[model samples]
Target: MGGCVSVSSRSTCSSRSNGERISPSCLWIDMFRRKRSRRTFSDHVTTLQHLSSIPSRIFTNGRSSSACIFTQQGRKGINQDAMIVWEDFMAEDVTFCGVFDGHGPYGHLVARKVRDTLPLKLSSFFDSFGSKQNGSGANCCNGNMKSDVADPVKETSTEDRVESLWREAFLKSYKAMDKELRSHPNLDCFCSGSTAVTVIKQGSNLFMGNIGDSRAILGSKDSNDSMVAIQLTVDLKPDLPREAERIKRCKGRVFALQDEPEVQRVWLPFDDAPGLAMARAFGDFCLKEYGVISIPEFSHRVLSDQDKFVVLASDGVWDVLSNEEVVEIVSSAPTRSSAARILVESAAREWKAKYPTSKMDDCAVVCLFLDGKMDSESDYEEQGFSSATLQSNHSGNVVESDDGQNSEPCLQRNFTVRSSEENDQYRRVPIDADVEDAENGGTEDQNWSGLEGVTRVNSLVQLPRFSEERPRP
Candidate 1:
């Protein structure tokens, strides 16, 4: 807790419009309640975004009613996952949460870079646009609420504009991120990159951006008041027909190996170089020609009064835990600060049990309770569930699948797909021209690929830009 850098005074970043700045407070997961200090943007704007990844859990307390906890562990010896959450984003009632999952040789570097930098980009843009979301300045931002402003008109006018602003920021930031990866003096993205899935919660609305296989889900009460899982983003895997179709349309090969029949991947049209499992990602310049893209899938949802929490996780968690199972585990946590840690530990245990032969993958989770805060005085009774009973009753329960319908025992065969060499009619053209493929010198690909110390991440890049010219090897 002491070692990890805790970002504070993020509300100051929203001060340009709200004119309200928060006092310095520990801004990690809701694990630790530190003394609050009034800080300003000029104070942390530079160093905060460059904060290094930590091996242990990091807690950043923002408000008394919100709690977020994070944890990570290495699998197969490398942890190529990263996560970041900026609750009280531009608008006080909003939160920005992101998880990145990296694969390949330099995946760890790419994931960490995105994990630390993306939110800063989003925050900068939000403040720049001056787009206001209703209730932005109320108690949420520590600013005065415009009580005279009508809700309907203010919401109707601001929602679309603010949303459009966020979309533009996502697109621009993703593009810049990929470009940075490709040109990184030390990192190589030719065959490496990461998946990204993020959600911006402003007021009751959620805006999500996803790329690759990692996922985001919401836990809310159905009409009957029972807890239910609502999937907020699709897993952008190569198996998706639309994804596969797009790859083929770009002359990119999309098929699975005989041994790994279920795991569809993208390969170089000319050389069997890097094979990426997800359809979209940042970097992976080598596969960009074969229809592998970095653009994100964006969607929006309005929160209901019954909405309880949101979960953003890397594939490591999704591969073993059902959206419902995750909801159950988190919802049952003895406390809000312990929710993410418990969920990650559960995934690690499942990975060991289900895939005994393979190394465990890095796992990361961000849990935001709708009304839960980071106050030490807030008791479990106030968190909407019985802490004493939530975890005790479901402590040993096994998770089934993503769908939550199957009750079968957990098995490796249910999620793991082996990779093998199999070929379809994929074009592999050799190039004679002096192609600038190695446009940027990269980080030690071999070393970073294993992510010896890096931990978990998730989801995307910019929108698709189909080019007629083939990619060079």
Candidate 2:
């Protein structure tokens, strides 16, 4: 497998001391001589100072323009899994980063495609949501402070609607990519899948969405003055009850690896699609038929001033360092980029120490540091309405034929609206397992205050909601 990567890395130096004023010819002559010495130097340094005397616009990012990506090919004995860091310091108010960890063959292509497309999909969704607002009232996504109580129901409805639209758009994008893969003469014979973890920063709030086992962590300045890693998303492993049920429905079972000498082998069952351990993922088209869904889990939170940095990494790095260990290492580092690189390099070193004669697996990590400046979290709290219900089934939208199979149809229908209090805490437990099946119930409508228009479909695997009543250290 081959990897195609384009990366740009930049470092800006801010110094307080001013050098003694020098002659223009001395600087010009030195610059000319340096240019003659190195051909590549001509492409390096495109700072405004070199181009013209006009002043450069100061960006809100607190740094000059910078971008970088790193790509590598693993040794012949190992999988050529390429990892990347596509950081652009100039984006300001929006720090975008993602981790793509691939397995099987041509993992590099999977990594490259994820890095290029995922962020664009998210940004486009945001754009669509923002464009709906008249922009004159309290609807301002540009972070300008405006006063007015927002409608929580409307906001929730808008958010849910946009989220569902984006989810469909994401699927469409993947389907288009699949079409391209089938048509391309060069990409045939590549059977691979990758896990993606993408994080986007809007002011002080961070939104992280992930698929598979890749992870993202938020490190906060703890009470002891040391940084503590606060995890955002849950790892989608085969152990979860919901996941176990899904796998079992697919005629596959997860087995505990016993210490027995004769049964020491750890492997997925023969009937399992792709013979992979992960229960949920993207690009493993072979498993889609059996309900091995690729729905992503997301976490949205406000980062306080006490927050230090974020770490997004592949399983290769996590296999070595725990969250606490990662916090310790990142806290000691001077910059987020260095911490990210160190994490990957550290994992490689650990692998070498454990196996003296073997090459390590491909590893990658990306970290974004909070530069001690305060950005109001409220400025980034997305306020909108979303009306996407959990099930795709509704009255006339999808019709059931006389044969009990769904028929293709185009329709719109009114859906039952359940209030937060009325619909709160309804669970369906089957009276008899042989006769009845448990159906998803409801809980208190999860809506941000005043944003009542947003109607969120209940997740089957609901996470315990964070509450101010309960202490969360």
Candidate 3:
């Protein structure tokens, strides 16, 4: 016979300047005392964000989380469809969790390119979010008590600032990626881009964002204190109702190409390119020009004490494993990183189960386990210089030197080099009248495209003269 179990607790109260009493909510979090599975909280605890910030600790017991990624190259034969990327960032203020899945030939290239630049972009966004949200502070005090105003205010203020930074970081990084891809000639062939689903963990807060089909799920400890699965980021596919409406606006059509329960394939340019299923992605210049919008759906949420861990996977992994099944395997593992490996392995196992003779597609999984420090032990020791730990002065620039005397402004750059043979092969003519004879030395189209990879990325070389706004440190 099942019966209801009620539990409650009392805490001290305080008063605020508004003369109202405040108290922390008495959360009736259920404890799973038995072996039963917990309820899924994907529908609840909405809103999540992702950003580049300080690194988070990897392990608690002096053991670092090991990452494992396997690429099978698939049964479809030549691994033509590439869609897997996994990056683990261990930092001070937060942990960078990212998974970028690409389609077609250039998906991997675009994913790799964006992955390296995300943190710098995030740093730029955090500065913006922090400025907007933390001004004059947020309201911290609430109901019935009046004396403990300062504590609540401090707590709320801190949380707001942290959450804001995380959210803005993601939005900015995504926008930057979109902008960067626009002018890149190397990305010309990358008409099909990638889906990125990432999360940054800071203390008890989790900031996550998703673009395209890749996903992130939170496995929370249920009422019985047993772990349960919760989806943090929504999958941005044309199959979803809201997403469908968005697609319609952009003159796109989505069709379910496969008959899988959990897996749904949607496409645009429906009559011809039915295989490009994901509605939103980075690059895919052809889609952009054809009015196929690729706006990402982002969310930001705080993980409660009940949260067990998070699982991030590509469509390759999710194609074979259901959310519940994935959660079970992941939650059973001793650590999050292990759970990530197990999830990928489970996908491979399922592929083997289905097609004993066929090879499987590339698969990747990353798990983030969130639990308090055991015995107040730190998960990671302070290591090399972290971008998050650096404090900026009143001028809003990070003073690299301890004495604030010799710090150089950080510049984001990418450089490429080519071999002499390729350079000679793609030799181009100079068009400047000042170099007349030399200008006509080569063919009309010398095809410097060969020198493309070796060229520096997006150098807006024409310098615009501007008045200096602030003094350098």
- Model 2, residue 443: C-alpha shift (Å): 15
* Candidate 2 off by > 4 Å: 1-92, 133-190, 252-273, 334-337, 355-359, 372-473
Sort the predicted structures by lDDT, highest score first.
1, 3, 2
The candidate scoring highest on TM-score is 1
Provide backbone clash counts, one per model: 40, 34, 34
lDDT of 1 by residue, 1-473 (tens): 00011122221123224454332111111111222244466654454533433222132211124645454644333456666676555435667778888776556667767776677666555554442332233243333343423344434444455557667777777776777687878766766688999888765567788888778889898889888887777677665656777898998887655554445567667755455677899888877877888888676665667889988888878766777788999888877766876788888887666655455666777787766455354454464333321222122322212221224322221122222322121112221222121113321111111111111222111223366988798
**C-alpha lDDT values of all predictions:** 0.57, 0.42, 0.46
Cα lDDT for residue 355, model 1?
A: 52
Query: Of the pair 2 and 3, which is ahead by lDDT?
Result: 3
Query: How close is every model to the real structure, measured as TM-score?
Result: 0.66, 0.54, 0.57
Runs in model 3 deviating more than 4 A are: 1-91, 131-165, 256-271, 289-291, 334-337, 355-359, 372-473
Put down candidate 3 lDDT per residue, 412-435, tens digits, no spaces: 211112234433433242322121
Candidate 1 whole-model C-alpha lDDT, 0 to 1:
0.57
RMSD of 2: 22.6
Q: Assess candidate 2 and give its TM-score to the true structure.
A: 0.54
lDDT accuracy of residue 406 in candidate 1: 23
RMSD of each: 14.6, 22.6, 19.6
